[model samples]
Target chain A: MQAFDIEVTLGRTRVLHGVDFTAKPGQVTAIVGPNGSGKTTLLRATTGEIPFTGRVLLNGEDVARQKPWQLAAIRGVQPQSTTIAFPFTVVEIVRLGLTAGLSAANTDLPVRALEKVDLTGFENRMYQDLSGGEQQRVQLARVLTQIWQPMVDGTPRWLILDEPVASLDIGHQFTVMDLTRDFATRGGGVVAVMHDLNLTAMFADRVVLMQDGRIAAQGTPSEVLTDATLTQTYGCPIPVNTTPPVGMPFLLPQARMTREPC
Target chain B: MSLAVDAPSVHAPPMDRRVQARRLTVALSLLLAVTSVFSLAWGASGTSLWAAMADLAAGRELSRLDRIVLFDIRLPRLCLGILVGASLAASGAVMQGLFRNPLADPGLIGVSAGAGLAAITAIVLGAMLPPAIRELTGNYLVPISAFFGGWGSTLVLYRVATRHGQTSVATMLLAGIALGALAGALSGILVYMADDSQLRDLTFWGMGSLAGATWAKVMAATPIILAALAVTPFLARGLNGLALGEAAAGHIGISVQLIKNTSILAVAAATGAAVAVSGGIGFIGIVVPHLLRLATGPDHHSLLPNAALLGATLLLAADMIARVIIAPAELPIGIVTAVLGAPVFLWILLKRRGALGL
Candidate 1:
C-alpha cells in the first residue's frame, strides 16, 4: 500500500502537508510522532476515512475509485476510540465485523479473535462495563475478526491502527504487539501510529518519525532513533541506547539539569 | 506476555438469537390478536361478543345494528390503531439508532409538532377555501398537508445538524427542541383565530383519538405507513454498522451518508402518516423501543421488527383501555398512553441516570 503527496485541510487549518508513505507486505511499519503531528490524519486519509488531495493506491487500484465494500474485503481499521451509546455485549460488538460488509465465511471468527486478545470469557459481558484496557482489546478483537486471515488470493490484507495500545496495560501491550508481529510474519501488512518509542523499537521493521506535519526521518530503528533526531524533533534531550541481546535502539530521556557542560 | 495455560469455558452458547427473535414476534402477534378481539367485543354500542361469534360460526346473518357497529365502526378503528402504533414505534427505534441515542423520539425532534401545526391549520382555515378546492381534497386534505409539514421540519433539522460531511447529535437535539417550540407557538396563534366548533375539534384532535377512524383515512395512510415499514429491514444492517460510529461504519463498507439519509426519510414518512391519522399520540414512540432494547440487545435486525409488533400491541391495548375506562363516553387514547408510558420512561431514566449524563 502507498500514499503519494497527501495534503489535507480541515476547515481553515492545513492539517497535513504534502506527505508520502508506504507500507510493505510482511512487515510492521511504525509511525511515531508528537501529538497533532499529522500521524492519525495520514492514516485516516490512507484508509479512506477522510478525503485528501493525493492518491492512495491499494494493490494497484486507486482507493478513491473503489467502492467501500470492495475496500472492506482487504483491509480493517481500528480507530482511536469508538463511542457506543446503546448497551452492546462484547460478542455482539465483535459480530458486527461479519455482517458489516465483508463476505467472509468464518462465522466463528469473533470468538477466536476474542481468545487471541485474551478476552475469551468476556463475550457475554456488557462492553460499557469493561475497563478502558478491556474495551481497547475488544476493539482489536473486532478488527481482527474483520480481517481474520492474514492473506487472501496471494495478496496480503492490511491492518491500519491508530494508537492501538494507548490504553492497554504493559502485559496487554506486549500481547497486542505480539499479535501484530505475528500477522506481519504471516505475510500481512501492519501500519500503526504508536506513542511508545520503546515498543516501536521492539516490533517495527521500519520507522517513520514525524514533526510538524512532515516526515523528519524514515529508516530502520538504528537510523531513525538517533539522539540528535529525537532531541530535535521532540524539543527535549533524549539519549539513544541499545539493548544487549537484540541490539535494538531505545530512547532514554536525560534531565537537562543533570547534564555536564559540553 | 506469556499466555495463560487454562481458560474456563463460558457456559454453552445462550439461546440462538434468531430463535429468540422469532419467539418474540410470535408472542407479540398473539397479544395483538387478543386485544383486537377485546376491542371489537366491548364498545359503547354494547355488542355481545359471545352472541356475535356464535352467530357468525352458525352462518347466520347479523342484525343491521351489529353490522353497522362492528363491521363499519370497530374494525376500521382496530386497523388504524395497529397501523399508527406500528409506524410510531418503528420510527422511534430507527431514530434512536440513527442518532445513536436512546432519548431521541419523533416528538422531541419536532416531526409531531410540525405535523400537528399543519393539521390544525387545515382544520381551522381549511373551511375558508373555495368550494372547488374543498371538493377536490375532501377528507384527505389534512393528512396530505400533515405529511408535508412533518417532512419539511425534518429536512430543516437535518440540514441544521449536518455541516460539511458530519452530523452532530447535540446540535440535532437542541435544534429539534427549538423547531418544535416554534411550531407550537404558530399552532397556538391558529387556535386563537378558530371559532367555537373549530376550537372544539382542535382540542379533541390535540389530545388524540381513534374515534374518528374511517376506512378512507385508513386507506389513505396504509400506503405511506406500509412503505416506510417495508424499507426498515433494509436499513437494519446499515444501522447496525452505524452503531460503530460514522467513520468506522464507513470502513466496514456502509455508505454512511446513504444510511443517514434513508433513515431520516423513512422516519419522517412513518411518523408523518401516523400523526396525520391520529393527532399527537405520545409514549409509544419513545417507550416501546426502550422496553425492547432492554429485552433484546441493540441489533437492529431483531430490534426493528420487534419494535413494530410491540408498538402495535401496546397502542391497541391502550386504545382498548380508553374505550372501556369511561364505558359509554370514550377517553382520549393519548391520555391513557401518557399515564402508562410516563412511568416507564421515568424508570428508565432513573436506572440509567449515571449513564445518561443528565
Candidate 2:
C-alpha cells in the first residue's frame, strides 16, 4: 500500500501536511509518535475513512476507484475500540467478519481466529460483558477472521490496525504482536500505529517516527531509534540501549528532577 | 505457544442461535395461523369461519350473508391487519438496525406523524386539486403523499442525529420528539380546517382502526408494503454488519451509505403505507423487535421475518379485542395495542436503562 502527498485538514487546521507513506507486503510497518502528532489521522486517511488531499494506492489500484467490498476482500481493519450497537455474543461478533470479507465460506474461521488471540473459550460469552482487554482481543480476532489467509491467490492481504494492543495486559500484548508478526511472516502486510517504542522495535520491520504531523525519521529500528533522535522527537531524555547478544535497540526514558514539589 | 498450552482444553461449541431462531420462525408462523383463524372466525357479525369451512367440506355453497361477512368484510380486514402489522414491525427492526439503537421506531420517531400530517392534508384539501391530477391519483393520492412525507422526515431525522457516521441515541430520540411535535401541530391546523364530515373521518382515522379496511384500501397498500418488505432480506447482512458501527461496517465490506439510504427508504415506505391505511397505530414497531431480541437474539436475518409474523399475530389479537370489548360498539385497534404494549415498552426501558444510558 502507498500514500503520497496526503494532506488532512480538520476544521482549518491541517493535521497531516503532505506526508508520504508506504508499506510493502510481507512486513510489519509501525508508525509511532507522541500524542496529538496525527498518527491516527494519517492512518484513517490512508484507509479511506476520512477525506484527504492526496492519493492512496492499495494493491496497484487507487483506493478511491475501488469499492469497499473489493478492498475488504484483500484487507481487514481493527479500530482502536469498537462499541457494538446490540447485545452480540463473542462468536457473533467474530462471525461478522466471516461475511464481510473473503472468508464467507469458512464457517469455522471465527473459532480459529479466537484461538489465535488466545480467546478460545470465549465464544459463548456476551461481548459487552468482557473486560476492556478481552474486547480488544475479540476485535482483533474479528479482523483476523476477515482475512484469515495471509495471501489470496498470488497477492498478499493487509491488516491495518490502530493500537492493536492498547488495552491488553503484557502477556496478551505479546500474543497479539506475535500474531501480527506471524501474519507478516506469511506474506501479509501489517501496518499498526504503536505507542510502545520497545514493542515496535521488537516487532516492526520498518519504523516511521512522526513529529508534529511530519515524518521525523523512517528506517530500520537501529537507524531511527537513536538516543538523540528519540530525545528530540519526544522532548524527553530518552536513553537508548541495546540487548547484549542480538543487538536490538531499546529505550528507557529518564525523568529529569528539575521541578520542585509543591 | 505457551499461552495455547496454558489455556483450557475444554472447548465449548460456539453459541449460535440460528437453529433456535429458525424454530421460532416456525412457531411464530403457527401462532399467526391460529390468530388469523380466530380473527376471521370471531367478530361482531354472526357469520362464522368454522361454519363456512364446514359447509365447504359438505360440498354446499355458502349463504349470501356468509359470503359478504366472511369473504368481503373479514378477509379484507384480516389481510390489512397482516400487511399493516408486518410493515410496522419490520420497519421497526430496520430502523433500530440502521440507527444502531433498539429504541428507534417509526411511530416514536415522527415518521408516522409526518405521514399522518400528509394524509390529513390529503383528506382536508383533496378537493382543491385540479381535476386532472385528482382523477389521476384518485384513491392513491393520500398514500403517495404520506410516503413522501415519511421519506422527508426520516431523511431529516437521520441528518440531525448522525455525524461522522455515528448516531447519538439521545440526539435521535430528542429530535424525534421535536419532529413529532412539529408534525402534530401542523396536523392540528389541518384538522381545524376540515369540514364536519371530514372531521369525523379524521377523528376515527387518528385513533386508528381496521373498520375502514376494504378491498380497495388493502390493494392500495399492498404494492407499497410488499415492495418495502421485499427490500429487507437484501438488507439483513448489511444491518448485521452495521451493529459494529458505520466505519467498522464499511471496513467489513458493506456499503454503509447504501445500507443507510435503503433502510431509510424502506422504513418510510412501510410506515407510510401502513399509516396511510390505518392512521396511527403505536408501539408494535418498538415492542415486537424488542421482544424478539430478548427471545431469540438481535440477528436481523431472523428478527425481521419473525417480527413480521409476530407483529401480524399480535395486531390481529389486538384487533379481536377491539372488536369484542364493547359488544356491538368497537374500540380503536390502536387503543388495544397501546394498552397491551406500553407496559412492555416501559419494562424494557427500565430493564435497559443502564445499557441505554438514559
Candidate 3:
C-alpha cells in the first residue's frame, strides 16, 4: 500500500504537509516521531478514517474511491484510543470485527482472534473491567478478527496500528511487537506508529522518522537511527547506540543537570 | 523479553450469544403475551376473562354492553398501549446506541415535546383555520400536526448538532434540551388561550391516557411504529459497530453517517407517531431500554426486541394500574409509568455513578 503526496488540513491548520509513505508486503514499516508530528494524522489518512488531498492506494486501488466494506475486507486498523460506554463482554467486542468485515457468519474467528491476543478465557469478562493493556489487546484481537489471514488470494492485507504498544507493559509490548513481526513475516503489511525507538529498531524492517508533518528520514533502521537525526528530530540530546550481538540501534537520553537541588 | 510462554489454546468453543438472545426474546414475548391477556380482561367495567373467552368459544354474539366495552374500548386501548410502548422503548434504545450514551432517550432529542406542542397548537388554535382547511384535516389534524412538529424539531436539532460530517453528542443533547424547552414554553402559552373544553382535552392529552384509543388511531400509528421496529434488525449490526466509538465504527466498515441519519429518522417517526397518539407518556423510553441493557448486556440485536416486549408489558401493566388503581375515575397512564419508572431511573444513576463518570 502507498500514500502519495498526502496533505491533510484540520480546520485552518494543515496537520500533514504533502507526506509520502509506503508499506510493502512482508515488511513492518514503523513511523516514529515526537508528539504532534502528525504520525496519527498520516495513519488516519492512510486508513481513510480522515480525508486527505492526495491518494492512498490499497492493492493499487484508490482508497478514497473504495467503499467502506471493500476497504474492511483488505485492511484492519487499531485506532489510538477507543472509548466504549456500554458494558460489552470481550467476545461481544471482538465480534464487532466480524460484523464490520461482513464476515459475521464466521462465528469462530472472534474466539480465535482473542486467543491469538492471549485472551483465551476472557470471552465473558466485561470490557470495562479489563486493564488498559488488556483492552488494547482486545482491540488488536478485533482487528485481527477482521483481517484474519495475512495473505488472501495472493494479495497482502494490511494492519495500520497507531502506537499499538503505548499502554502495554514490557511483556505485553514485546508480545504485541512480536505479533506484528509474525504478521509481516507471513506476508502482511504493517504500518505502525511507534514512540519507542528501540522497539522500532528491533522489530521494524524499515523506519520513517516524522517531524512536523513531514518525513524527515526513511531508510533501514541503522541508516535512520543516527544520533544526529534522532537529536535533530526529537530536539534533545538523544545518543544512539547499537547492541553488539544483533546490531539493533538504541537511544540514550542525557538528563539535564539542575543547579539547585532539593 | 524471550518468547517463553506456552502456546495459547485455539480450540475453545465460542459461546453462542445468539442462542442466549433467542431465549431472552422468547421469554419476553411470553411475558408480554400474558400481560396483554391480563390487560384485556382487567378493565373499568367488571368483565371476567372466563366469560369473554367462553362467549367467544361458543360462537355466540357478545351482549351489547360486553361487545361495546371489549371491542370498542379495552382491546383498542391495549393495542395502542402495546404499540406506543414498543415504539417509545425501541426508539429510546436506538437513540442510546446512536449517542453511545445509555442515558439518551427519545424525549431528550425534543421529539416528544415537539409533538406535544404541535398537538396543543392544533387543539387550541386549530379552530381558527379557514373552514375549508378545517374540513379537510378533519379528525386527523392534531396527529398530523404533531408528526410534523416532531420531524421539524428533530431536523433542526440534528442540523445544529452535526457539522462537517460529525455529530457532537454534547451539542445534540444541549440543543435538544433548548429546543424542548422552547417548544414547552410555546405550548404553555397556547394553554393560556385554551377554553374550558379545549383545556380539558389538553389536560388529558398532556398527561397521556389510553382511554381515547380507537381502531382508527391504532391503524394510523401502526404503520409508522412497525416500520421503525422493522428497521431495527438492520440497524443492529451498525449499532453494535457503534459500541466502539464513531471513528472506529467508521473504520470497521460502518457508514457512520448513514447509520446516524437512519437512527434519527426512525426515532423521530416512531416517537412522533407515539406522542401524537398517546400524549407525553414518559419513563418507558428511558427506563425500559436501560433495564433491558442491565439484563442483556446492551447487544442491540437482543436489546431492541427485548426492549420492545418489556416496554409493551410494562406499559400495559402501568395502564392497568392507571385504570384499576383509581377504578372508574382513571389515573393517567403517564403518571403510573413515572411513579414506577422514576425510582428505577434513580437507582440506575446511583448504581452507575462511577461508570457514568459523574
Candidate 4:
C-alpha cells in the first residue's frame, strides 16, 4: 500500500499536509503521534473513507479508480468504534464480513476469527451486552474475517486499522498485536495508528512518527525512538531506555516536580 | 504465544438463527394463507366459502350471488389487503434500516400524511386539469401524485434528521410530527373545498377501509407495490451492513449511497401506492416490523419477508374484526389496527426506554 502527497481538510482546518506513506507486504507499519497530529486522518484518507487530495495505490491499483467491492477484496478496515443500530449476535456481526471481498467463500472464517480474538464462545451473545474491550475485539474478529487469507491470488491484502488496541486490556492488546504480526508474517500488509509507543516498538517493523501533520521521523524503532526526538515531538521530557540484551528502545515520562524537587 | 497455544476448542458450530428464521418464513406463509381464506369466507355478505367449496365437491355450479360475492367483492379486498399490508410493513423495515432507528415509519414520520394530502388534492381538483392531461392520467392521477408527495417528504425528512452521516432519533421524530401536522392542515383545507359528493368520499377515505377496494384499485397498486417489494431483497444486505452505521458499512464494500437512495425510493413507492389505495392506515408499518424483530432477529434477510407475511396476515385479521365487531355497518380497518397496535407500540417504547435515550 502507498499514498503520495496526501492532504486532508476537515472544515477549515487542514489536518494532513502533503504526507507520503508506504507499507510493504510482510511488514507491520505503525503510525504513532500525539493527539491532533493527524495519524487517524492519514489512515482514513488512505482507506477512502473520507475525501482527500492525493493518490492511494493498493496492490498496484489506484484506489480512486477501483470500485468499493474491488477495494474491499484487497483490504479490510476496522474503525475506531462502531455503534450497531439493532440487536445483533456476535456471530451475526462477524458473519457480516463474509458477504464482502475475497473471503465470501470462506464460511469458516468467522469462527476462526472469533477464536483468534479469544471470543470463540461469544457467538451466541448479544453484541450490545459485551464490554468495551470485548466489543473492540469482536470488531477485530469481524475485520479479520473479511481478510481471512493474508494473500489472495498471490496478491497481498491489507488490514488498515484505526487504533485497533486502544480500548483493549493489556492481555487482549497483545492478542490483537500478535494477530496483526501473524498476518504480516504471512505476507499481508498491516498498517495501524497506534497510541502506545512501547507496544509499537515491540511489534512494529517500521515506525512513522508524526508531529503537526508532517512525518517528523520514519525508521525502525531504535532509529526513530531516541530521547531527543521523543521529547521534541511530544513536547515533554521523555527519557528513553534500551533493554540490555536486545537493545530494544522504551520510554517512561517522569513528572517535572519529581525530577527536580521543589 | 502461550494464549495462542491454549486457544478455545474450535469444534463448536458458530451460532446463528438462519435455520430458525427459514422455518419461521414457512410458518408465516401458512398463517397468511389461512388468514386469506378466513378473510374471503367471513364477511357481511351471506355467501360462504365452505358452501361454495362443498358445491364444487358435489359437482354443482355455483349460484350468481356466491360468484359475485366471492369472486368480485371479497377477492379484490383480499388482494388489496395483501398488497397494501406487505407494502407498509416492508417499507417500515427499510426505512428503519435506512434511518438506523426502529421508530422510523412512513405513517409515524409523515410520509403517509404527505401522500394522503396529495391524494386528497387529486380527488378534489382533478377535474380542473386540461383535457389532454386528464385523459392521459385517468385512473393513475391520484396514485402518481401521492408517490411524488411521499418521495418529497421522505427526502426532506432524511436531510433534516441526518448530519455528517449521523442520524438523530430525537430530531427525526420531532421533524416527523411537524411535517405530519403541516400536511394535515393542508389536507383539511382541501377537504373543506371538496363538494358534497367529494366530502363523503374524503371522510371514509380519511378513516381508511377496504370497502373501496376494486379490481381497478388492486391493479393500479399491484405493479408499483410489487416493484417496490422486488427492490427490497437486493437492499437486505445493504441494510444489514448499515446497522453498523454508514462509514463502517461503506468500509465493508456496500455502496452506501446506492443503498440509501434505493431505500428512499422503494419506501416512497410502496408507501405512496398503499396510501393512495387505502387512505391512511396507521400502526401497521411500525407495529409489524417491530413485532417481527422481536420474534426473529433483526437480520433484514428474514425480517423483511416475514414482515410482509405477518403484515398481510395481521391486516386481514384486523379487517375481519372491523367487519364483525360492528356487524353489517362495519367500522374502518384503520381504527381496528390502531386499537390493537398502539398498546404494543407503547409497551415496546417502555421496554426500550433506556436504549432509546428517551
Candidate 5:
C-alpha cells in the first residue's frame, strides 16, 4: 500500500501536510519521529480512520474509497495505548480481532494469534490483570488474530503496528519487534512506528525518519541512522558508531547534551 | 427459540464462557415479559390469575368495578410501571456507560429533581383553579409539566456536559448535582409557600404513583420506550467498546462524540418520559443494573436487557406490594420501592462490607 500524498486538515489545524510514502509487502517500514511529528496522524490517515486528503492504494485500489469494513478486512493496527476497562479474558479480547474481516468458518485464528505472540497459556487469564508487557503482547495477539487468518491455499496477512511496544519493558520490546520481524520474514508487509532507534536500526528493513510532519530521511538503517539525523532528531549530542559484540547492531550514546564533533 | 440458544453459544460457547451480549438480551426479554404480566395483574382488586385470564380469554363483560380497576387503574398503571422501569433502566445504563462510572444514575443529571419540581407546581397550581379541573388534574397538569421540567433540566445538563466536543464525566456529575440542588431549592420554596392542604397534596404527589395511569399516557410513553429500547440494543457493541475508555472505543471504530451525544439524548428521553409518568422513582435505576451484573455479567448486550427486565420486576412487585400491604388503600409505589430496596441494598453493603470501599 502506498499513501499517495495524504493531506489532513482537522477543522483549521493542518495536522498532516501532503505526505507521500510507500509501505510495501515483505518489508519492515519504520516511521520514527519525535512527539506530534505526525507519525500517528499519518497512520490514522492511511487507514482512513480519520478524514484526510489524498489516496491510499492497497493492491492498486484507492484504500480511502473502500468501505470501513473492506479496509479493515485487509489491515489491522495496535495503537500506542490500549486501556481495556472490562475484564474480558485475553482469548476473548483476541477473538474480537478475528471478527473484523473474516468468516466464522475460519476457526483456527484465536490459537494461531496466541501462538504468534507466544501467549497461548495466558488465554483464559483476565486481560486487565496482565503486566504492561503482557498486555501489549495480548494486544499484538488481537492484531495478529484480526489480520492473520489462513487463506484457502495457506497464505499470511498484512499488519500495521503503531508503537506496538511503546508501553512494554525492554526485553518484551525485543520480543514484539522480533515478532514483527518474523511477520515480515513470512511474506507479510509490516509498518512499525517506533521510538527505539537501536531496535529500529537492528530490525528495520528500511527506516523512514519523519520531522515536523514530513519525511526528513528515508533509506536503509546505515544511511538514515547517521550521527547527524540522530543528533537533530533527539535535540541532544550523541555519538553513532558500530561494534561487533556478538554482531548485534549497536549505537551507544556517549553523552546526553554535548554535540558530537561532526 | 433456537436463535436464542445458537446466537449466544456462537458468540460465547460453554467451553469459552466469556461475554455473551445476546444471552443477556434473551434473559432480560424473558424477565421483562413475565414481570410485566405479573404487574398487570396486581392491584387493589387483587386481579386473580383466573379472573385476568377469564377477562382476556372470554371477553367477559367485566363488572363496572373490574373495568375501572383494569382499564382505568391497573392496566395504565402496569403500562406506566413497564415504561418507567424500562426508561429509567435504559437511561441509567447509558449514563453509567457514558460517565464510565458504574454507579451513575439517569437522575445524576438532575432530571428527577426537575420532574419533582414540576409535579409540585402542578399540585400547588391546581388548587388556585376551581374544583372543576381537580378531577382531571393528575390526568392533565402532572405529565405535561413534568415533561417540560424534565427537558428543561436536561438541556442545562447537556450544555454543561459538552465542552470542546468532549464530555468530562466529573464535570457532568458536578453539573447534575448543582442543577439538582437548584431544582431542589426551587422545590423547597414551593413547599414553604404551600397551605396545609396544598402541602399534603404536594407531599403525596412527590411520593409518586401509577394509580393515575391511563391508556393514553402509556400510548404516549410507548414510543419513547420503544425508541429507547430500539436504539439502545444497537449500541451494545459500541457501548461495550466505550466501556473500555474513550480513546480505545475510538480506536475500535466508534465515534466518541456520537456515542456521547446519543447517551445524552437517551438519558433525556428515558428519564423525562419516566418522570412524566411516575414522578421521581429513585434507587431502582441505580441498583437494578448492578444486580443484573451478577447474574448476566457486565457486557452491555446482556446488562442492558437484564436491566430492562429486572427494572420491571422490581417496580412491578413493589407496586403490587404497595397495593396489598394496606389492602384497598394504595400507598405510593415509590415509597414502597425505596422502603424495600433500601434494606436489600443495606444487606448487600453489610455482607460485602468493605467491598464497596468506593
Candidate 6:
C-alpha cells in the first residue's frame, strides 16, 4: 500500500501538502513528529478517513474512489482515542469491531484480538465499569471484531494504528508493539502514527516526519531521528543517543523552548 | 511530548459475538408477536379471548350484535392499537438516535402537539368545506393534519438547525419543544372554535383512541407504514455507527447528514401516518424503546426492530386494558398507556439513568 501525492486541508489550514510515501507488504512504517505537525492528518488521509487530494493505492487502485465498504475491506484502523458514555458490555463493544465487513466470517476475531491485547476472559464485564486503559483495550478488541479476514490466505490486510498504546501500561505497550510486528511478519503492512520516538526507533522499518503540512524527513529510524533533523522539525535543540536497543528509538529532548543554546 | 502518545487499541472484536446481536432482534419479534396477539384477544365489549377464538374457529355468521361489536368495532380498534403503538415506538427510537438523547420523545418533543393542532384545524374547517371534506373529518382529518404538522415543523427546524452537515441534537430538541408548544397553542384555538359536538370529538381525538379504526383506514395506511418499516434496516448500520457520535460515525464511512436527514423524515412519516389513524398517543415511543433496549442490546440492528415489535405489543396491551377497564363504556387507549407507561418509565428513570442494563 502507498500514499501517492496526498494533500489535505482542514478548516482553512493546509494540514498535508503534497506528501508522498509507500509501504509494501510485510513492513512497519512509523510516522513521528511533535504536536500539530500533521502526523495524525497524514494517517487520516491514508485511511481515507478524511477527504484528500491524492491517490492512496492498495495494490494500485485509488482508495478515495472505492466504495466505503469495499475500501474498509483492505484497510484496518485504530484511531487515536475514542469515548463512549453509554453503558455497554465487553462482548457488545467488541462486536462493533466486526461492523466493517458485513461478510467477514471469523467468529473468533474478538477473542483472538482480545487475547493478543491481553484482555482475555473479561468479555462479559461492563465497558463503563472498566478503567481508561481497559476501555482502550476493549475498543481495540472492537477493531479486531470489525476487520476479521474471512479467507485464510492471499488477501493482504493493512493495519493503521494511531498511537494505539499510549494509554496502556509499559507491559501492554510492548505486547501491542509485538502484535504489530507479528502482523507485518504475516505479510500485512502497518502504518503507525506514534509520538514515542523510541518506539519508532525500535520497531519501525521506515519513518516519516511531518512539519507545517509537508514531509520534513523520511527514511530509516537512524536516518530520520538525528539531532539535526529533530532540531529542525521541532524548532528546538534535541539530543539523540544510540542507547542499548530499547526495542524503540530513544531520543532525549535537550531543549523545550530555546532553538539554540547560548 | 505529544509524540509520546500511543493510540488506544483499535482491535475490533470478531463479528461472531456481534453477529449474536441479530438474535436479540428475532427474539424481540417473537415476543412482540406473542404479546400483541394476546393483547388483541383480551379486549372487553363482552368478547372474551375464548369467544373470539371460538368465533374464528366456527367461521359461522355472527349474530347482529356480535357482528357490530366484532367487525365494526373490535377489529378496527385492535388494528389501530397496533398502528399507534408501532408508530410512536418507531418514531421515538429514531428521534432518540437522531437527537442522541434518552429523554427525546415524539410527545415530549412536541411532534404530537404539532400534529394535534393541525388535525384540530382540519376538523373545525370540515363544516365549511365540501361533503367529502366533512366525511374526512371525524378521525381522518386529524391524522392527515397531524402528520403534516409533525413533518412541517421538522422541516423548518431541520433547516434552521442543520449547517454544513453538522446537526446538533440539543438544538433540534430545543427547537422541537418550542415549536411543539406553538402548535399546541394553535390546536387550543381550534378546539375553542369547535362547536359543542365537534368539541367532544376533538377532545376524544386529542386524548387519542383506536375506536374509529376501520379496515379501510388500515389498508390506506399499510403502504406508507410498511414502507417505513422496510426502510429501517437500511438505516441500522448507519445508526449503529452513529452511536459513536457524528464525527466518529463519519470516519467509519457513514454519511452522517444522510442518516440524520433520513431519520427526521422517517420519524415524521411514521408519526404522521400513525396520528392520521389514531389521533395522538403519547409515551409509547419514549418508553417502549427504552424498555426494549433493557432486554436487547443497544445495537440498532436489534434496538430498532425490537422497538418496532415492543411498540406494537405495548399498544395492543394498552388498547386491551382500555377496552376492559371501563367495559361497555370504553376509555381512551392513550390514558391506559400513559397510566401504565408513566410509572414503568419513571421506574426506569429512577433505576437507571443511561442505557438499559443489557
Using lDDT as the measure, which candidate wins? 2
**Candidate of highest DockQ:** 2
Residue B28 displacement in candidate 3 (angstroms): 1.3
**What is candidate 6's lDDT per residue for A189-237, written digit by digit as tens?**
7888888887787778898988888889888999999999999998998
Residue A71 in candidate 1, Cα distance off native in Å? 1.4
Q: Write the number of the candidate with greater TM-score, choosing between 1 and 6.
A: 1
What is the lDDT for B3 in model 1? Answer: 38
Query: Of 2 and 3, which scores higher on DockQ?
Result: 2
The local distance difference test score of each candidate is 0.85, 0.91, 0.85, 0.89, 0.71, 0.72
Question: lDDT of candidate 5?
Answer: 0.71
Residue pairs with colliding backbones in model 2 are: none
Between prediction 1 and prediction 3, the one with superior DockQ is: 1
lDDT winner, 5 or 6? 6
lDDT of 6: 0.72
Candidate 1 lDDT tens digits, B6-71: 433355464445567778888988988888788788788767777888999999998888888888
lDDT of 6 by residue, B9-77 (tens): 233332333456577667767877787667655655565656756876998655676777666776676
Over B1-358, each residue of candidate 5 has an lDDT whose tens digit, in order, gives: 9878776544443344434555656766777678767766665565465585787698776677767766677778887888888778777777777666554675556778887788677767656766777666546566556666776776677677755333555677788899889888988899999889878656655667777677877876777667867778777666776655554455445656677667666666677667766767777876787676555556676677767777877788788887788986888888887786667556654654442233
Interface RMSD, all candidates in order, equals 1.4, 1.3, 2.7, 2.2, 5.0, 5.4
**Which scores higher on TM-score, 4 or 6?**
4
What is candidate 6's fraction of native contacts? 0.09
Which order, best to worst by DockQ?
2, 1, 4, 3, 5, 6
Which docking category, incorrect, acceptable, medium or high, applies to candidate 6?
incorrect
Sort all candidates by TM-score, best to worst: 2, 4, 1, 3, 6, 5
Kindly list the per-residue Cα lDDT of model 3 for residues A54-125, writing each as its tens digit.
988998999888877888888889988776878898998998888754466788998888877888888888
Error of 3 at A127 (Å): 0.2
